[model samples]
Target: MTQQDIRKVRQEERVAELCAGVVRAFSGERDLHFRGRRLHRGRMPLPWFAPHLHPSPETDDFESFRGVADGLALRIAGSDATLHRTLQPEEPVERMLFEMLEQFRAEALVPEAMAGMRRNLRHRHEQWSLAFHHSGLTETARGLLLYAVAQICRARVSGEQVVEETEDMLEATRFALAPRIGHALGGLRRDRFDQAAYAVHALAIARTVATMLHEAGGDDEAPDARQNDTDDKRSVFSLVAEMDREIVEQHVSAQSGRSRLLEEAGAAYRVFTTEYDREHEAATLVRRELLAELRERLDRRIAAQGVNLARLARELRALLAVPERDGWDGGQEEGRIDGRRLARLVASPAERRLFRVEREEPLADCVVSFLIDCSGSMKEHAESVAMLVDVLARALEQAGVASEVLGFTTGAWNGGRAQRDWLRAGRPAHPGRLNERCHLVFKAAGTPWRRARAPMAALLRPELFREGIDGEAVDWACTRLRARSEERKLLLVISDGSPMDSATHLANDPHYLDHHLREVLARQEQQRDIAIAGIGVGLDLSPYYSHSHVLDLAASTGNAIFREVIGLMAGRHRH
Candidate 1:
């Protein structure tokens, strides 16, 4: 790691330590620990206060970060989690508003004597407001409405002035919402200390906002009755369009009902054809110079993250190491009395039967395979994934464990040659896995990580991503892992979503691949030949894998990401 990177890592460590002490002192929650930018009470993350816990250069200063720390501490101390949970609205839009309002309520409860803390809170909120507004989130109607509600709620509850910068921009929204939520706003201030009482008013405002949003037709339209020029405009219009499409798609699927292809096929999976299946070395697919460049870039990024590889290696060594009874030791200082050493004991009377009949040694006899989902959506997270996997591989190697980096994707979009061949065969019923399987070997188990570094960069090659056939990929990775001579084998599958072969889904059923993937996982898990775990890139893989860890790639920093991965390897995830 470079000097600057080292400094950053040290600073983050100090911040975490300080914040942890603050959380403990203020909340009296002794078990809360900060990890992956989120504070966790045991394994469950306290994500409600995530925004305040982030350690950034700007927030690293005394006043700025203390405000963040104080706000978070107050949130934990003031908010009643059980009450919040019980009172939370069911609707997504309403629920978001309810949560935001609750956070403001907590921040508003700052002690009167702590003038510094009060200023800190006001300053931080203003900073956040400015940042949110400048980010163009306010350009969209929904974003602006949410921003306005947050500003008004914070100001009302804390008895502080609203951010001046956004006051003009939110004037119309504030006016529109005032008549509807005036009484609720008063109740929120009156009942700020009483969570159950405050929730009534909070929910009232939340429901009002949600109702307005629904009545507005879509989030694209203004929540307020008035149509301002700014309300209709959005900087990233495509994102709103995409969200609309997803909503429509979900509605259509709900109406259409689920596919019964599994029952029809009688639990037997049938592939259209395996003629198009291809397995290739990932390094060979890309140009040498480009691969090297990607590797260099990855190295710099990983180094900047300043992951303590040595410490990680030690932890992995402790976790993965297996105890083995080597053999009996003769003439030991103290151990089980060995009958064979009685003669020696007689020769040296003080020795007594000191020979040890058993000796245990920790052996790092394990192989870990990382199976990556190279689906199209994963392209956005490719760089982060590559960095995480590469660092892990290096750490595993340092710990004397074998590691393999592999990926799976279809050779062509929407089932390429396999679909054409299936069509030629008159589109037979229940044709499972219509896509051409393309398994990639980025780094083999036998190869050292240093030598295989270039190929591992293939994870960043966008074109290599096409489609994901998760079930087959898992089976393939398990097979390779099981083939290893190690005493223990582990297969870690990383993916954002489920098995999605469009052609197979369309030709047979939407759930054909999903069922197959589940079946594969169940069978492998039952046999226990190898331990199968999952790391969801930005999703929950619990539906598929029994043991899974969800990594929020967007919210987490590199060190945080690595720590989470290590926790997964140590089997810290929920069973």
Candidate 2:
């Protein structure tokens, strides 16, 4: 790594440690940790405060960070999560207002002795207000209204002056909202210390703001409506609002039932046919020249990511290694008596103790298999998936652990020969799997990564992607891993979505394949012979695997992604 890059990493680590200390001290939650710029309370993420947690490196100032930390600490210690949830509004604009108001209320309660904390809070708010204004958000009708309300609410609750920079810009908006929420604002200032009493006024103000925005008839798109469609910058309020929606959506998706069939008594999972199943070396499926070109491109991308492979290998070795007695230590100590040390003890005449003890060292006697989900939807993420698994395989090899890169997909779209056979059999009810299974070996465990680089790049071949049958693929990987003599076995599945087979869903039930995948994971988990974990490519795979992590490859650096995957394999994230 370059000196600059190394310095940047160390800075981030220090900031993370500071933030973690703040969280634990304020929230009294010892398990809360900052991972990849997000605060995670164990497996669950506290995403609402992510923006504050990420301080800009260019403007690195501890006072600003202290402000952010103190604000979050107060929010956690003073606010009631359950009460906030009960009083939260449903409308997006209203919800945003409600949350922002609650945060200010908590910040308003800073202890009288903490004058520095109060100054920090005000500075942070002023900075956020200036950033929002300078981003052109104040030019839009909806954004101006939200910003004006936030400034007014914070000032009212904390008894501080409004930010002078935006005072003239917000005059008209402040006047327009005064009549609708003036009474609620008064109540907010009056009951700032009482959460229950404060929520009533907060909710009232939130509903008023939402109602006013709706009446303006542009609340939905006004924030970014004027910006170029291709522009990636987003207002902080909108980003936090979007995060709220995503959390709700993920929860809903996780709760959606797909195991009805599996829950039924005496229900058995069966396959329609296995005659069309096929396994092949991935290198054979592509042209040599194309494979070499893909490999060069992949190598370039990985190099650009600047991942420290040696560090990753060391961490993996520490996590996966097993203890073994490599040698003996002979000395005059409290261990087994050593015959070789007897002569020295006799000569010394004062050395009464001579002992030899076995020394145990960590040995990487582990095997890991990366099973990629080569489905039609995953085509968009093929390059990233390939790069991730390739880097991981190389690192595992360097750690003295065997690794395999494998993939699974269907032989054809919908179903191939398997569906035809089912049709010939009169379409029997509850046909478990109606798709033809195809497994590909990109690189075997015993092969060196340099030799298999070309074949591993075959993951970029679009033609190989089709449907995905995850259950059988998991079984296949587990069986292969079990056959190895390694003391530890790990299977990591990378997929963007759940198991999908059009023919299977049409022939039996919509959730037939989903249920089977769950069953297979459960059975394997029960066996406890091999460890299985999952990495979701911009999606959550918690419904299928007991240990799973959602990876946003686009937003995360390669090093962060690898660390997250290692954390999952080490069972740090368990759902």
Winning model by TM-score: 2
Candidate 2: segments with Cα more than 4 A from true spot:
1-73, 88-96, 110-147, 169-184, 207-319, 325-353, 373-402, 418-434, 442-488, 493-575
For each candidate, give its TM-score against the true structure: 0.54, 0.59
Q: In model 1, state the lDDT of residue 238.
A: 29
RMSD vs true structure, all candidates: 10.1, 9.1
lDDT of 1 by residue, 79-112 (tens): 8888888889776666767877888889888888
Cα distance off (Å), candidate 1, residue 130: 36
Error of 1 at 280 (Å): 0.8
Q: Per-residue lDDT tens digits of candidate 2, residues 494-566?
A: 9878888899888777887877887788889888888888787755566567666767666568599889889
The residue pairs in collision within model 1 are: none
